[model samples]
Target: MNNLELTDNVSAAAKRDIFELQKKIGAFSNDEGAEEAFRKYRLTRGVYGQRQPGVQMIRIKLPYGYVTADQLVRIADCSDKYATGNLHATTRQDIQLHFVKLADSPQLWADLEDADITLREACGNTVRNVTASATAGIDPDEPFDVSPFAQAIFEYFLRNPISQEMGRKFKISLSSSEKDSALGFMHDVGLIAKMGKNENGQPVKGFKVVIGGGLGAQPFPAQTAYEFLPEDQAIPFIEAVIRVFDRYGERTRRHKARMKFLLNDLGLEKMMELVQEERTALKNKVYPVQDIAYSWKNLGERVPLAKEEILALADAQLEDSEKELFQKWLATNVFEQKQKGWYGVSLRVLLGDMHSSTARKLADVMRQYAADDLRVTINQGYLLKFVKAEDLPALFKALSQLGLADPGFDSTADITTCPGTDTCNLAISSSYGITRALEVMMKEEYPDLIYNNDIKIKISGCMNGCGQHSAANIGFHGSSIKNKKLVLPALQVILGGGFTGANSEGQMGDKVIKLPSKRGPEAMRTLLDDYQNNAYEDEYFNQYYARQTKNYFYQLLKPIADLSEVKDDEYRDWDHDELFKTEVGVGECAGVMIDLVGTTLIEADEKLSLAHEMLAEGVWADGIYHAYNTFITGAKALLIGEGISTNSQHSMVKEFEENFGKTFYPEAGDDSKPFSQLVFSINKNEPTEAFARGFVGKAEDFLKNVKAFRAGQLAENSIPALQELVYGQDS
Candidate 1:
């Protein structure tokens, strides 16, 4: 679409946001400090810097992976115009467009907004896209549709103040049934639909809540927070937990800032106590989720063929080899839904990358034969819903033409991988390269294993686990081994991790050994060979690993771990001819740390300005939270000037009082209320206009005091690193 057409399609608010982003980008081109600040801001808006300089990757949020045909076409157009003519479907069910010039991001965003799609809060420290089971509405075993609840949470958190500037990114997922198809066990907050009896013994709707789970450098399994929390209380409960996390979660140590760490520190019981303490401060005590009216657009009134007739027609049309392959595809890729006469067809996009032209074709196919509802699966595949059973053959043929009709959907052959050395700044090795090699090996050598759905293989370029390696039955993440003077890229092999599915628990992978990156395919072959020979009938991969134990696998793969026998080629990383040299860049996944005192003070002024803007707009709660951050930024700046670095805002407030309270207010001594008490008043009182104005006034005074204090320190030349302060220091 042209600029005018795009502008006409979006709301005035979205247009303003895109224009402001363009203005900020232009400003940053002239000022390096402004670039650092804008980098953080843009990430929250879903524009992320790729590993390559001067280009960006824009992540588009798709709640529950639901996309209309028109939206897909728009995405394809945007990819063709602004990106590399490709869309990468992420494990989180979001689509990423890579290799776009930074200057074009605003235009790209405007184009997406034209289709009612968004890039806002798709990355950075905000609550990410709320994911749900791809089979939410059609699952036979589901108690109720989880789409409404997931959508509700997505709407509630979009532009919500509580999570906009969190210590780290937050993830929430809703599962349709006990099957946990959404992989709820590995998210920050996981909700599984449940049916329970109220006090009066009537059936009530609720969720089985799990909290604090995460897969990163260190993986943590989520713990149960509630056996059955009434559906209406879900939002309030989540908001309360977020408030507690915002107030107390670590900020300085990026690696230690996840909600999982807070849960680990406080324990589940104590964490729940803190959550309860914040209940009174929540914006809503009970947010009843209204049932969403979801309708599938019927392509045409074509009569569905009977099962016998469909089989007969397929037999007549297919050649012997084609029929055999079609049977395998149907057995592995097509799902019979709860809806009679309908099916869910899964297309495995190799490594989650689909060319723009192919995507446009897929959209056309959906509009012609399916329900026009396309859901991206968590395993980097596409699930086309509500296809007539008879239409499967035609759909398969069309998908085959587009190279998407692969057999294995979520089986071992359907490997999950992250954009490692391909685009991510923190990736130390080439995950995509190794993943391609492994997939080829599996299809060519272990073709019969395509139907094995019990085992999963996942890979990440690093231990950050963006590929969710920790939750796989067999997993690998990038690493390195130093042998004498040579450093070779390596893959850390992990085993025995996977979900048991429906009424069962899951386990995180145990690290077994590290092997050269080139030998990853060989290592996979060995693991599969051993499993085939030793496993009992129908024995799952994790169960077999548990019986054999970690030591056994370590011994089995130990030969490959011997660096003394490494060849010259072992020094090379996958997809690169040059010898491996780890060039890990600073990850902007959680936003960069700002350490310059002056820059921090400038940020405080910005926060104050936002506070005033929010208050003027009558968003009292958001204005109060912004004012609260203003206080934190000013205090942190003063503390940094004193070389007294604190990890969290809570600590910053306490340290400020301890060091400067007596000097600033001599009479109020130890008997006075702590500075935390004053700054944290945002949650103590109702978020009314009077309170918002009062809080903003207090923040203004605090910023003035901090600026004056810093000026005096500069006059005395007491602060160190006057001109050498780095803007992105971690601590």
Candidate 2:
């Protein structure tokens, strides 16, 4: 069946979501108050605000990096119609389209959903796309496929009430094998597939669970939460962990709102204890992941050349230069799959951006000479699977025509970068521009390094690490320097970071020095030249960097960092004609922040309603968590009204007790428990029907009292009215 013709069968839920988005978009024109709220809502549906004012960026969620040929064509068509004719494959295994008008997003989403693709929860504070190894089903080193597990998690969290409005965005990754090709260790939650035996000595599938890992201004390596967790318990365990984070994670301090920071504040032992405490409220103790049977058709059976013809072609190889090029392309870009007589070809996508025309051509190529399925790699590339070995030459020629058959696949010549100043609001310099300069320098001056995969180069617009600069062997993040009266774009050089070996133990880069953005290529050259000349035989870049230390590189690149010798051209940033200025906009990467007292109270009421709904549904754990959030939200609203800012939900609980507990309801039922103690009973009691009902009742009373208090303050003019305060402001 043609995948494109598969049916525009939109699920009722999806239809409702699309309709709601349309309504919100329509409402935004008349009601300015709805703009921020709508922006937040659209983000959860994958409509992100771009650096450009009038347009948006759409991110399409593709679980585990899996894409079918038909889906690719559909995306290409959408890009051509609704956005710039380009598709950017993100490191998280999602595809992004830029320069899309906000009004056209609904139609674009509908177009994608026609092919059963979704943009839901692709961004925002919700659980982002769940990723896994690109080679999951076919990797020779994999113990078993992780595709099903990743898909299960992706589905479970799509609109799960627990994660819809978290303190920060959550990420999850599953590796097919211990090799951790998915870069699992750097995600919010990482799962490594493992095989173990039960008490009866029968083999059982499981995962090595890691938590709180992330890449950002402050990168944290994930700590092992469980050496082995049974497959059946994975979902429930993950849900409990999220519940804990939701109730206790930071809220006001955006910078400290990630799971890693939460884990840092609460020791691993205490965090585990909290997770265990929430298990009683869980909707399921064990969720059995159904086996996924994945099969690919169209594995190119037709050989364009006969055996004798292929032999003749091989023997007639002509120029030594042509022969060497072919050999290099084969060695770097082609790898034998576990399946006999089949190979996987890696297509290096320059900076992860491919024009729609190129994408359609690649899809057509897949329909003819490879499997219908393709996997987008974590390093911003594509892996074409199930190609017949006999078709290698023809395939290379086809890809070469598309400018995708670059000899280096994930080698030093293959640089990874984020959109940076091109489209990211938080960027300090031009990451894409400097990246191009560096790549050209490497290919032109240090061509031999194309074969070296040990050294990776990654650049981020800023220290937020969107480009995963902290995970590179040699990294640069956008920064700036101050001269007497001017500012210049700069790159913060970092060293000694990357995957140490096949086991996937990752090391974060250390900041070495900052240099002018225009001189980034020279800085890279300096580091590579030093490593090449001084390193011992067989020493990898990371090992050599560790031996030389950060000071060594800082001293070597210090000349470039000297702002005293700044030239006139240094005043302009890469790819920019005007003088450099640090113009950063508020980042919506974590979702819009609503600070209106009334808006917050309304959110509290909504949480209360959701708690009631969950209680009716008999989802005890979910109800209890919702009630907990209701109390926190109500208290936060009142506190914010008093001009008291809260750094975290936990701190809000304490602050509310200190400020209002004694003045308001001083005691509760039996034993005269304080209001704070009563509200906190959520974590103390098991998630039973009785406890859920009682906690929800208390939350109801707490919200009522909070509303009454606010009314009295309003009547007395002691607090600013909603209209008096700046409302609907985007943060």
Candidate 3:
């Protein structure tokens, strides 16, 4: 049997045993007297700071996780052609892409927009992507069809005036019936639509509300803020809650500002009072909703379908592929149709991502294949609803191009990942990066890991928990080195994460190992190595990691192991003390982000061991600023979350300036004079030309040979437009 086939029969315990079975599998060759390794970048993926360098988390709206087959085809085409094709299905029933280059984002976004889909405030600190249940009218457990409400909210929130400016990012989830696809309690606001009664005991169809729930670094189990409100009041009530958050929520410290935090501190009663006050004020102001007909579900109208035509085409015209296969798909993939002879077919996608080459060809096949329509699911899957049985293989093959065809849906390794450090600025560790590494590792170590339904891995780059790592079976947070000399990054590797319609909050895993700061691939390998040997039968990585004590795992990894010269050795710097050390004669080094797309967001990236200066463009280089932004947002000082005491020292800048003498900037042309020497020359009170350091630090052109470098000077883009200023410097 091939290696892949060989892994199927091995007990899971054997996989777990492999992790602990070896003490030192390889040795890392230390380069004695060599240069040091440093972490590369960091950034956030939210809207707390407009234009902050962050991952542009695009949420493709899936109304009830249902899209037309054409929509699905376009999504697949875009996935491979625009994004990496590894689309992630969010619990909210949206698809998210990572590694999206900044320049291409607008085009990619336009694709969705062309279809009348949106990319309006998926990222940034606005009302984030809205969520809805997977099963709408068809679910046996549903109360009433909520596809309309979900559609309404999506339409209303797109660049809405009031929704754009929020104190903290907000999330909204709705259940179609009592059995909701989304974790209602985990959202900032939960809405359950139903046919109900009002306080006056009048029969009404409306929504039941639950407010103040969120999951992140600070997980809060949302409580029911309001039991029920009439149907007409749902949108207004939600608006009121959001306005209250904007008015009362803390803006300076993000951690303290989640609606739940505000609700908790104010107490639910007080929160309701405030909500009432906000609602009253909003009533006085003009509302943005457009009222349309609502019939508790078009219970009487029967939507007709081209059923006879579909049967005529399928029964006689299908000349390719297997007929029995098509029949079976019709049985398993078809959904309850409101229209006669019409049905929705669900096509599960494992891992929420698709390959491009596969996606493009699928686009062609979809146009010619099954139903001409499809839909996306929140489960990181999609549905080719409204399709006839005869077109199943063609639809399947087209999807196969996009790699969306995974029959073993919801099994292990169909893991969802939040755009990690690879693209996100706020992530603490490289979530996607590690995911890539772990994918290879898991496939190699246990090819049949997915076949065993017990395992899963989810990751978020930072604590805002965008990937919903909190609810994954194995959750990983992005992290970075607090110190350049340190080997380990600050990681809170959580375990015991899970999600379900019955119970939603997944316990966070333990910090078995710190990320090796920037060495994402290496850190992932270590975690996988540990997982291979320690797990048991029917034991997924999350459960095993949760059950084992931190000490137990630490002891196992304590001994030094030999590694290849290429191995990442983040273990050198793991403690806080190593991160912050004071020394004389050695001037401090710092990096900060000046602009991201175009705006000031965070403070300096973790202090670099050395600072660079570019005369061609003032002091800071474009590359340096890019690198700085990556680390800056993730540094403990920026997030300053509410309940979590970061012990960050952002305001200590004055103290820092006082302790370290303002250093001099460097010269590009001179190779003999290093930055340190130039600083020393300035410190000795030497005369020199002046310069700028991108508005962050003090800059003195401490070099004696500045004239030669400036001789080939490049004109500033902005300054060139000022005719009089450029001609005379306004002197």
Candidate 4:
């Protein structure tokens, strides 16, 4: 189809967002004053500024990693046409296309939407891509598939007023079963499928919910929010929880802005109390998830290849070594589906990157051999489902030809690494280059580790854990160590992290030592040798680590940490010919810090407009939330104009009343209530039509008053004070 045809298929809301991006890009080129505001605006729509100037990275959100064969082909075409011809799959199950010009992004977003793909809320302080276990539908042990529920959450929150802007990003994961393959313990909100009995003794579907988990410079395990929350209440509960976060979560201090930090500051009980308060304002108390687009019942008709014919061909065509390898592949990469005769196959994607040509071919293979739904694995691979048992050999042969049939899907041999210095602005060292070296070393020296899936090796470009290094049995995050005159790229070796038991409890890795990047392979060999020779039989890596103690491993690897042994080549980072220099730029992973008082007022106006629109559409709760944000944003803007910074929305409300209540709302300051009470009424009142309309009207008046006050202040000589204020929390 032509670009116009593609654009014709775009949703009205999506088209408006894309057009806004296009306009913002033009505005930025003409006036640099729009940079910070445009940065925040573009990120919410998934356009990210890259390390290199004049280029952008676009992250495409695929809820639960569900992508059709046709969708894959479209993504490949976009990569070739707009971006570099490489598609990078991220750990959170999103695909990223990097090195695209900023001017091309709006069209890129438009083209992808033709395939029913979205870039909305893919970045920024919003609800990110909702992930689930790749084995959701086909897993033999799952109580019921979590895919539908995950999809429901993703849809409900996309463009929802509550999550449009927040202190920091939120992540949710739904695991197929208690095995927690989706790694729920590391998410802001994690749900594990559960089968429970009601008072009538009838089996009911629900989830064991966990909340406030995260990984970054510091990692926190999710705490149990509900031992068994009925499935219908999932979305509503999450909405209430997000409402609390949007109000109270840290905004100015970027480091402490995640939900986990908020949970730390306010204990779980207090947070839950706040969540209960917001419940009255929610659109639904029980939003039932009915069905998903990629449900099993919707798999289109397909003629299965005859079992006898395929097995016979397999016997005749396969050599002995190939047969042995096939068995190993079956043992590691393939699993019997819950649908007796069907199977699921995993293709180990090295470093989570695929060339467009190979991706197109893989899409073809997916169409012919597997179901249309292809799940991007959390470990940065692809999971193909609904393969018949008889077609295994033929499917394997097709994948082998494409060089995607690598064994050890999530084992030690399969290493996960972020783009690092190759593309990411925050990377201090090269995670990709070191990961490749470590993978090669593991294969050449310890190929048998493919049978060991218990030990996972993860690498990240930085301490933010994009590669999830903190969740690996053996982990490495990019860093640098200084020697007298020169700085050498270093890997901070971490051990004793991963899931512990059947419940999949998360353990953040402990930093053991720092070694020069070139010696990473040597460090791996030393750790592996020690684990291999001294561990109790069948003991997991973390178990062995506990027995040896952190000090023992530290002393053992202390020699490698010595800067005296560093060579001239050590000063050069891996895969680079030039001398290394620290080039870490401002990290955008937490989203841009909101600055500029006038811009804040403009954003408040936008929220006021959305409130009016939603109120007109009769979306009461959403309209109310938009109105609520309008109050906070307007108050924040006025406070910023006075050179008074506020951190959280809650703080901003109090600050507004304290500063302007006597002058603006004299009656409220005396006996009735303050500005805080008016705004805080959002959570206290139910979201009825009358309340929503009144709230939206109040928001409009508030913004109008704030803008008038700002105009009066600017009429005086207060423009410099208004513009110079930077909003943040006191350290």
Candidate 5:
């Protein structure tokens, strides 16, 4: 394995993760069930398979979208080194670099971790990046900053044992305030900052909590779990929730596996009861997060302008056009900070993509005119905080020079879109192409909409909702319609979906109609024109949509959806010269579980080794959890060898007892109980050193028995060995 030549300052854990990835990549070809096994492993480390073969997309996790200028420069450097020179900001507040070779993933990860940024758990069925409002700390309406709390949640779950191998991906959000800028209602756990008075009349910091929200083909609004949950118990409460999810979440039916499904199946009351049952095993009852806002000072090599130069630039005159553009930008993108005279500036990144050169320039701009704190917005833009009011002109000039100072920051023109057909396997059409066309049309025709914040336009390549289309006032997802035998790319028009500035009652767009990909621009124009002509004065887009009704909009757009007079270009999807074809591959937005008997046992052995290593490092909780995984993996291996379907951890436990509890592995020993009891003990006992040691010992004995039974089966030729199953016998 090739090791990184990183400085001693790099984290030991990061180095180990990289080394493990390299080792796995090296051994992949020889392992049985390698394709499925390796795919699951790499995804947890943030290396994802792209739509294009022989390349991967590396997702760099930026918790709460916070990035320093120096860190931005580092990311740019890595983008130039390991990927195409483009950096794509995702709606989840992550930076994704595409076209990375699988072998280079380890070094790319190492280079990123060298700058205190991580790729860990960035993509996978693990705890994804914890998001917050881009205006988190500085929002004028916020009760308190949610940055530190978001960071704490991110840190607590990154590589934590409870969330590593869940049945589906988990998402969490911490909105700055009741405005819910982070869209708290769309996450597994949504927390909005709230200040309350205690019994003694002292001010207490807490959150109004919501749980089990999600957006996909089927969207669900989160239920209000608590009106107020004290800040101190945040980590423990989340920990308990994840534990319950890990145990009970679905595995066989991929579509029915999100936490929302689990919540729906077992109601909120029953879910809370399970969470209460697991609280005794939590590591921290009260985790007090540190305030991170104090560390916003610039720390980069870029030089800043002198005080006199800044003053002069602030006072500098602008041309007529430049002045008009600047005024529009100020109206749309600039907002006052809660910290008196300072301002927050949002830079609208076209399609959420910028070249490496642009990123480096952005870093310099951050150092020159703004605080070191750079936030990636959920709308796929950049937010620079703590800019002095006087410095706005200089900042605007600098950003404009980079082609990033578009007037619309998060408006109708500022369309949120995912990398649909360009990189995602699930995307059915070209989101980038359609988004570009819409933006150009909007800029040329409806230039005044840049100042309109009441309407949101969002696009997703598919129904997966990575671009968060379901929550926008106007949304479109990629689809296809057949004309005779030819398939034409289409966009499903959705309307009336939006947040009402209240987390408890968020709306999801209703599907109105589908139009050919080429007609997407026309559809937007038609909607805008209709609203402008018939709506009540000062009415928002959603209100107009509500008034018009779904059938009304369908009738209105049914003309655009008509294929009777389709042009030749209509046969082709956006940005593609070739005719359209529906050729979507398997979606890896959330990696699926595919374990064979042979490789599953090997994985079990590996987990046992990890358990011992954790024990040696005195990480009792981690060790106990690893041992717990060992039990599940070993039991799963035997059941899979028997061709029994393994759907979920909880189900597998029950199935193992029903199938072979006292049959092949008879309960002869005095200490032997049901296999389910041994595994369930993890959540029943505290994670002390003694319990961890004993649990690991029990796991070792369990694995030995499993291996012995497997050997007997092999001797009888009842099951194929790893090599024979993967390759062939009689070499």
Candidate 6:
């Protein structure tokens, strides 16, 4: 899409409004006029898709999942600025604006660019934004600070050549504590901090490395690659891990590109054998840099405070009635500092939001109470570190004014969700909105039920499973199809998808339950109420789900499902398919989140900056990344409106040649036909849409744009670095 020097489409859409705004641009061909289209592609944050006829979707990138309060304001503004005032947050932490006209992406990008947010790395194969503990530095229990390293990696990896054309997407995670909230155990490479007595018996910090963990068509847990690599060696250690993955990973299978599968197939002994040799050689090539690879940075000067500060600040922050509950939440949710009088508190938000005036307030509050530092966690939570006891009360009040001092600090509402159905073309359900609605529903209907520790409700828009429904105790995956004679909306309800420190891939529920039309929010409320009230003693949400299959849930939910009076039948959610089956895919949560070795997140950054992560240093080939990419490419072909059973004979190569540019000279096969074409082929305006009845018609146009929406996963992973230079936009 980037080949165009300028966009001057000879065949463009007519702005003339008709009784109905409808027209066919014909097949999106890269034909003679392709260059101009490519030209416009560069200036715009997104391209057009035909998930349905006469509709388009726009994607916005959020680097490393970092969006400032101002940027969110920009999102709210741009939503008003163009299309509709609605934004969708993605599993990748990117935001998407749907219903966008094909002609408006440029202005949208220009507006977003004004806020230093770029749609560039939002998709394509580019190095994605670096993620870390939202509670970094502020968590007193953290052994090392990870923000610097995550930032450095984000800076270094963006547009780097070696990273750009990765055999498959490379994911790296960094965490500083052992709480394992970041799920470091399930990433391409996970770094966890291991704090203990060193040989000298004094406090020391370093990492416990885990490699090759991912979830997808095939799920695998990350493994320990190394232990006790001092804080200093973090950069070289990660570089070594990358080299191991890039060199020895699989390349032939679309289902096997992830590093986790590699670790499983090769076994750690053999994997390390390859890595050790590579590391030895790399060290020799970089003399001075190699020498500092094992130094521990956390042993530096400690930040101290008075003991009275922690007590006073926390005591002062609470309202009379909320003080007790707030204190308990704080005790469990906040971290105790090593210093006598300081503490770090977690500022949790619903689905990664600290909006508008609150953003400004939080920053100010942190500055006043904290030591000018904060950490962002992959879980979309924030941290305020080094607060004196005296300031805690006021800080809490300030945060409460911002509507952020919700009691769910570590409670269920401190949830993580991807923007689904609302904006993403790939999305099938409204994950976050629904999550919020559900949270509220539970609060109103069965507040005490959710207070129990074991139940967590997670939702994903579609099969890509961004919301991680497959891992939640009560998970929801969005899907659509028609019933005997009607169109409908539905969610493949999963009962038991759980992830804890002990195991992986929680039990999945069965049956596709219909969503309530006007009372969709009420439908979830019913399910939650039923579960909360009927749950077995000591049974967590997933455990209860395991006891009852999706079939049972559906049977229980049939009453609510039958209540739909949706006018546009197509928008009605129903027609349950084999959606209840639990199938996990190979997807890493993002590396910057899982890999923490020592409390310092930036140690890797300093090390990477100093040693420089080289392309040749790591030979990249992973079966999973390749498989996922190829799967997406193949999936795209099937989506092109055809007799698309699991098994199909026809292909879309003919259309690919006419539509996609030479860069994507699709071959005559299922794998070669770009998926974008298949999605665009969907007929949108069909009031009696056949795909999923009215629901597909209501949302089909959104689906067609899924392929075109990949801002960083497909094409942006590579960039030619000038020996020691790095690239990326920081929030």
Highest-lDDT candidate: 4
lDDT of 6: 0.49
Q: Of the candidates shown, which would achieve the greatest TM-score relative to the real structure?
A: 4
Tell me the whole-model lDDT of each prediction, alpha carbons only. Answer: 0.86, 0.84, 0.48, 0.87, 0.86, 0.49
**Tens digits of per-residue lDDT for model 1 on 367-389?**
88877679988888898888887
Error of 3 at 665 (Å): 49
Give, for candidate 5, the lowest lDDT window spanning 10 residues: 297-306
TM-score of 5: 0.94
**Residue-by-residue lDDT tens digits, candidate 4, 1-731:** 12332457789988888877787787787884457777888888898878898898999999999999899999999999999899899899999999998888888998899889999999998999999999998889999989999999999999999998899999999999988888888899999999988889999999999999898888888999999999999999999989999999999889899999999999999999999998888999899998765645655434544545555667776766677677678779988777766778999998899999999999999888888989998999999999876778888888888888888899889998899999889999999999889888889999998888888999998899999998888999999998898889999988988875456577788998998999999899999999999988878788899898999999999997887676889989889999999998877775665566778877887898899889889899989999999999898887887888878999988888888878668656355556887899998888999999998898888887887777677758666544333211220
Model 6 misplacement above 4 A = 1-122, 196-204, 227-234, 240-256, 261-277, 280-339, 353-358, 368-371, 449-454, 500-731
Cα deviation at 459, candidate 2, in Å, is: 0.7
> Against the true structure, candidate 3 has what lDDT?
0.48
Q: What is candidate 2's CA lDDT for residue 160? A: 83
lDDT preference between candidates 2 and 4, better one: 4
Model 6 alpha-carbon miss at residue 450, Å: 6.6
lDDT of 6 by residue, 1-731 (tens): 22112123211211111100111122133242233223222322244342343445556655435555456566767776675665544444456666676545555655666666555444432344445555554445677666566655555454333343233556666665775555565567766767756678887666777777665535566777777666566665565555555544543343565667777877889987766655542322221122112122233344554435555656655668766655655554555665545667776667764444455556667656765444444445665666655666676667767766665554554455665554455565456656676667666766554244455566666755666665565566666545456544456655555553233332333435645333455656666667768878766565666577667777876776663444553353333222222222222222111111111112223222222222122322121122223323333332332332221112233433344424343354645544444332221211121322322222223222333332223345453231112112330
Q: Mind giving the per-residue lDDT tens digits that candidate 5 earns over 310-393?
A: 345545755556776877787788886777667789989989998999999999998888888899999999999878766778
lDDT of 5 at 458: 93
Error (Å) of candidate 3 at residue 264 is: 2.6
True lDDT of residue 161, candidate 5: 80
Each prediction's total of clashing residue pairs, residues at least 3 apart in sequence or on different chains, is 0, 1, 63, 0, 0, 113
Q: Write the per-residue lDDT of candidate 2 for residues 467-578, one digit (tens) a residue.
A: 9999888899999989899999989988888875556487788988888899898888888889889999987788888887889888999987887688989889888999
- In the order shown, the candidates' Cα RMSDs to the true structure are 3.7, 4.5, 18.6, 3.9, 3.9, 16.4
Give residue 222's lDDT in candidate 1 (0 to 100).
91
